[model samples]
Target chain A: MLKNLLLNRNLTCLFFILIISSFEKIHAQNAQVINFNSLQKIYSNKSDTTYFIHFFASWCLPCLNELPDFVSFSDQHKNEKVKMIFVSLDMKKDSIKTLPQLIEKFKINVPVFLLDETNADKWINMVDKKWSGSIPATLILNNEKKYKKFFSESMSLQTLNKLVK
Target chain B: MIKNIFDFSLLVAICVLSLGFSIKGNKSSYDFHLKNVGGNFVSLKDYPSAKGFIIVFTCNHCPFAKLYPERLNGLNSKYKNLGVPLIAICSSDTITYAEDSFLKMIEKAKNENFNFPYLCDGEQLAAKNFGAQKTPHAFILWKEKNNWTIKYSGAIDDNGAEPDKVQHHYVSDAVDELLKSKKVSIPETKSIGCQIHFRK
Candidate 1:
């Protein structure tokens, strides 16, 4: 009986270890590092999905201030055809730990990605030749990849709604 | 066939993406008369001796701006004698971010032991005229017959987060070329930094 109990406890510990690691893996995969070209393909492809991509950084105060509104907006429109992505332009170094913390801090369920690019000159113009490389910028795209708009500053839920429509 | 199709689609997507907005670039530099941290007014035209100006839109609370204090100090002390003094601007709305108030700016200047004036853009006059969107956004201006013409505008260097690891020197090289009476080689560069907290 004693031996059986000990084996059961060991199995339970192994099970938890597996679950925790898999959870971490899923979360890691969710925040997959992407560049401008890769992301252009995903949102600009031809389907019926509306793409709302918001650029933010952990260090940006304005980005932090208006994030909850964006998150709640996304939550409220969960069933809609709109797909929201929160792109964290945070430096690639600390984002592994910091991104998770910020997500947990706000209890955000929206998918967040880290824009993994170093050469700003090449990629900045690619996104929108006119983007002055400002944070809290946003991009909304339609299925045909024709109806697209870029906001170069912090926006509210009302602004977000109007853009989606 | 796939290559042609891919290229054609990308062109269409880019045309659609870049339709509405025009990215701000080189233009005539704007003149300003704003108060420094010391409560005195200063204007760009006052520096008659300077061959040009390094008007950098910066503030106290920005991490990117904070990293450049030593660099700014060096730029001023080294080039002030060369007739290219650096003028830093804080365009952040003080009402929204109390840490960026004039009082704190003075404290920050004192703590940093600044050699140059750090002015407060009380009304965001300079920021708007120059179309400056980010803190630590640098513009290298060279004087023409009378007016100062903007020659280069963008980041200070290739890297804003790390200094020692920087490979390209954008502002310094431009300044050096201007001092030598030669046209700047690479006119512009870009980097990530804090957006200016302008009030709606």
Candidate 2:
């Protein structure tokens, strides 16, 4: 009886560990890191892929609230040659703590990036003149050749679908 | 001589009428006010000693605003003494996000040691008047003769994320030009920051 109880406890521990490990693995598969240089290269090389760049900050409640829609949209359209990039506008200091947690919590299925540029104005203009440095802003590009549209509001999947299509 | 005088008066009347029309059109920028962090009311008229007022629509929760807290503080400190008083307004809806409430605003101001008066636009009337769509939106008001005019409106600097990378300091440069009795070259630029949270 004693031996059986000990064996049962050991099995339960193993089961919990396996569940946690699988969860971690699944999360790791969902999020990929992309830097500015990598992004430029991807856009230049894969001209067929539609790029959706999202400007967000961890501190922004609207951005946080809208993240799930973005993740679901990315998952639903994985085979459509569409790519989603989450560009966090979080300060450089908060990147390590906030960025990964946000990516995990939102179950983001896309490349995540931190805007490492120092000057806010220069980078903002570089992205688009109409951006106005607003969080939860999205820039949709068609095949890296066309400037599709820019939205300075929380996005819905319907809107994303329309833009991509 | 009487006919010449009458003609000159007619020309002056036409010019005056056109100027009045333009000022009325531009009244939107001047028609707003915000409650200061101290819960005291303040408006463009409150700064009687100022040649102009720098109205910055900013918030505590925006990373962009957090990044430039010191730069803004410095601008306020330097310019306030020189006759251009800075007024920082928070138009974000604090009812939903409790972190942006008036209390948090006080904490942010105290923690940042802000030299300027941080104001709260509780009803967002001021934001609506200016059509402010984003946090960190700026409007530089200049007093011309007795009327207040908008000299510059938009981003504070060319650098959004990195202060060190700034190519142009729009607010400071405009104030400097105004001090020199010259016109601001760039009157407007695109503003970037968190979207102003309007209450439903």
Candidate 3:
């Protein structure tokens, strides 16, 4: 009986380890690193669904303050045709650690992506000519409706709801 | 009733002040009398022998601005004798970012051993006048007919993360061209950094 109990305890430990590792894997897999081309593809998709792309950085205080609202908005509209995506503009050197840490800390369940590109001058105009390369900026795009709007400031949940539809 | 009148007068004063400095290049000259980190008020007019100025909008809290201190120091040393002294201003809203408070700015300047004068735009008047959008935003103003003309505006260099890999020295190159009486080849550029939000 003693031998059986010891084996069972070891097996339980192994099972817990597996669960934790897979949990981490899922967390990491949720956020992907994408280039500007991939971002263009995402915005260019001509579908009935509206895509809300929020551009932010870990170091930007205002962006952090508004993240939870965006996440909650995404949660409330999970079944709707509105798709929320977060794209981080954090520096490449620190994004690997900081991006995931921010994701986990914020309990953000929506799909996240790290924008992997340099020379913002080249692509910033492409994203939005009005965007002054500021954080907490959001882009709402729906190719089917031919509707696009960009805001370079932190927004409220009420504002998000009003604008998404 | 008296408070409302006072508010209206204040708004009028702000409008008049903002109109003094135009964002467009060669439109108007801008002047600022801001407090320096050295516990004294300094202005562009203080430098009587200056040919122009390199005014940078920066703050202590922004990580991107932190990376450019050494580069700014280098630029100041390289161009100070050339009659274009570099002046850095911290115009970040202290209410939002305590790290960017005037006291913290003094501490940062001291800790960094900054050779150039770090000024405080307490009201963010200078930032609004220059239409500065982000931290580490650079502007090169040249002395033309006794007025400061904005010849170049934008990032300090091409690379913010890796200074060694910098391909274009936008600010300095503009300064060099201005000194030689030539037009700036690349007058404007954009950078990725923390935005400077206006105080409510």
Candidate that would win on DockQ: 3
Model 2 lDDT tens row, A71-159: 88989888888888788766667676666677777767577777665555545666667776667888777755655677888888788
The parts of candidate 2 lying over 4 Å away from their true place are A1-41, A44-46, A144-147, B1-29, B158-167, B189-192
For every model in order, the fraction of real contacts preserved is 0.53, 0.62, 0.65
**Every candidate's TM-score, chain A alone:** 0.83, 0.73, 0.85
Task: Name model 1 segments beyond 4 Å from true.
Answer: A1-30, A93-97, A143-145, B1-29, B38-40
Tens-place lDDT digits, model 1, residues B84-152: 999999998888778889999999999999888999997886898887888889998888888788899
CAPRI classification of candidate 2? acceptable
Mark the 10 consecutive residues where model 1 chain B has the least summed lDDT.
B20-29
lDDT agreement with native, every candidate: 0.83, 0.78, 0.89
Better of 1 and 2 by lDDT: 1
DockQ of each: 0.33, 0.46, 0.55
Q: In DockQ, how does model 2 score against the reference complex?
A: 0.46
Supply the DockQ value of model 1.
0.33
Question: What local lDDT score does residue B50 receive in model 2, on the 0 to 100 scale?
Answer: 86
Error of 1 at A145 (Å): 5.0
